[model samples]
Target: MSNQKTSDILISEVGPRDRLQSVSTTMPTAHKKQWIRDLAAAGLREIEVGSFVSHKLLPQMADTGEIVAFARTLPGVFVTALAPNLHGAQDAFQAGVQKITIPVSVSEPHSLANVNKTHAQMFEQVRQIIACRNAHYPAVLVEAGLSTVFGCTIQGVVEEDDVLRMAHTMAELGVDEVGLADTVGYATPLQVHRLFTRLKHDLGELAGSAHFHNTRGQGLANVLTALDAGVTTFDASLGGIGGCPYAPGASGNIVTEDLVYLLESMGLRTGVSIEKLLVARETLKQGLPNEPLYGFIPDAGVGKNFHYAGEKA
Candidate 1:
């Protein structure tokens, strides 16, 4: 059975949205719904089900509205979606997402390439999005995910000062939270620690989740660093199956199963069932049969003496 206990950490699963958008194969709406159900059943309270992007631009996410509708039916699950602009945010609000994450790239080049907007324009869109949310869906939460905060594949060597400035701008625009994303997987542990520490010190309650990619095999190390820096929320994928579609050479998010095991073994309660998470991974594989899945715990299996954080040893 899934754990009924509350968690000390929040693992926001992003496989359905982030992973699907990057892949060429479009998972059917039914399969997407089933995958979400399985993930929630494994005790993932927050799930980024899909994005509110154009079908022509991202055909894989064409059924996002339907996915959101289905995910809303699951009890105790917080449904979230990515919305790159005012139009997408409006669609997401209408679709009933509990939270909307807007990617605000810290790198100017990345911002232009990802959403075809400058920093000022992106901030303006965020203002409009917040205005629309306040005027209509006051209950919906808005988060500005600061993409390429670590470094950019296009721009290269994004400054920490610039990232802090963008995050502060988003906060000033009325976002509920601001998260740092290693969009191209260029983050190191020391860099992650220093930035996140500064972010927490600066933003306090507004400092949000850590989104890391395993492109350089530093994802887990970065996670540990962020956790030590007082970050309790994290973003991971079911099978490490996500990367920035717009960021070249970026591949794989930190795997959900491994992340759960890491936290649980460290005596941090994530409230996720590793066995059930593995089951959810199977559901993911069934949806994208040809797609390659990555994770260590899935291959190695848990140790004989393994136990969940809150469980009696």
Candidate 2:
């Protein structure tokens, strides 16, 4: 179940890919490299470095291959990238990403609008991508992410049964892991707990990271519920800088700095150094000055008396 060997809670940094893709301003490649290095040095063991999609569609991800290459050189870092379809998965494989996440929306309309493929078509693409990985890069892991599992902006109130069915199908298809994503920030803590609990029961070791948005300010609450449901891995942005491009009204992922603060304060070990994380986030700010960066911990600073879990006071 572990992707890396260091932490009790694995905070997978998604700012480079997820945040950069959503924003209009593109971060320079060298800044991205430094930011990722700083993140790794700060004790983040896993990072979603970039996406392997068409540059025409998302020019922000144009340098993903380079970013993946750079991220691979950092010791102890597991580099991941998002691949929308079989073609993008192949590109990711060729680029040598340690893991590839392919998002499939349980909401049919969302699936179509996001990737221009229906859920059934996406299923086929996943099969093809897995086959390609098996034939060429067996060591690389493919994760099936159930985006919009809670609800969809395009078509609201996504069915829970449909999500379970798709997760079951993904497990059957041999994906390394299956995860739920609150793509449009439509999840409540109760819904997150219930759905994640069900996903764990259905997928067992395959139920993976929780990707939540703070659009409605329910992201941390959902994380608490997911942890109660036995999920450890989480996807977060450095400065709370991302949202789904196709899912309207989806604003940003939960801020990584704030999430780490909460986790460490609760005695759950995340291994990220809050001080260094803030420094790394400054790199992000410098890279994309026009884009807004959000985090509670950064503004308020760590408590003078607070110490991370296991640190001697």
Candidate 3:
């Protein structure tokens, strides 16, 4: 019932950041800029351009700051980037990202492995980032993206209570939003429904996007479940490319093109133009010529009778 009408859903494209960071080949900065422009033209309002981590850690994201600066010039686009800690957050803020997402893995082993910091240490870092934002960049939104909430490849079976506790703590820490991530792609539809239902109940307006991976091929199903649970936003990669480099065997986020087609077909108003999205996909391919792109809609095409949500029928 919550998602019955033509609801406006946000599909936050993370290909420029998440997918690129996972690959060995670095996309040229010019090509990256063009890809982002094409994506924005497709009506993707929010885009995670890149991460503000060290060049040594992720050279693929070395051009994040430049990308952020370029993306900010585009009207009506909410530019975002990932920041691992206070230092990265500072860099991201300085680069003029309207929003920044900090990964906070729920599993202890994952927390240690991903960022080399325990939950307590990460919380401290988050606190510092919040103080920095409040003092200087008060307009920038800081989002805590809770990773590996469904299950972890490193630790396996993250507890729901732990996930809720982390979200509650993030809300208390003055974070703008807290989102749940299926980092290793082990979630089923029922699990997604139950967990997101609880997440929205606990965090209310602070409950943010759903980041699902198609690693186990359940991504779209999980999205439907989350939609029913009142999630209005999702994080997706352009070609179903991307994985947690730290979380082994975790590959393929939900494809943005397919996600748009799915949402539009369901009478959900995502504001993305599928025709333009396909063109953007071509640009992504041009940037990363060797990479494989995945999407059923891209391959099969929309049928003759299909109409986008809210279209005159």
Weakest 10 consecutive residues of candidate 1 by summed lDDT: 1-10
lDDT of 1 by residue, 134-238 (tens): 999999999999999999989999999999999889889999999999999999999999999999999999999999999999999999999999999999999
- For lDDT, the strongest prediction is 1
Q: Candidate 2: where are CA atoms >4 Å away?
A: 1-4
Give the alpha-carbon lDDT of every model. Answer: 0.93, 0.91, 0.91
- lDDT of candidate 3 over 1-313, digit per residue (tens): 0121334898899999889989999999999999999998998889999999889978999889999999999878889999989999999999999999999999989989889999899999999999999999999999999999999998988889989999999999999999999999999999999999999888888999999999999999999999999999999999899998899999999999899888888888988888898999999898889989998889998889788888976
Alpha-carbon RMSD to native, per candidate: 2.1, 1.0, 2.5
Reference-based TM-score of each model: 0.98, 0.98, 0.97
Evaluated at residue 140, the lDDT of candidate 3 is 92
**Cand. 3 Cα-lDDT:** 0.91
Residue lDDT tens for model 2, 148-217: 9989999998889989999999988889999899999989999999999999988888999999999999
Using lDDT as the yardstick, the better of models 1 and 3 is 1
The positional error of residue 81 in candidate 2, measured at the CA in angstroms, is: 0.2
Q: What TM-score, to 2 decimals, does candidate 3 have?
A: 0.97
- Our model 3 lands, by Cα RMSD against the true structure, at 2.5
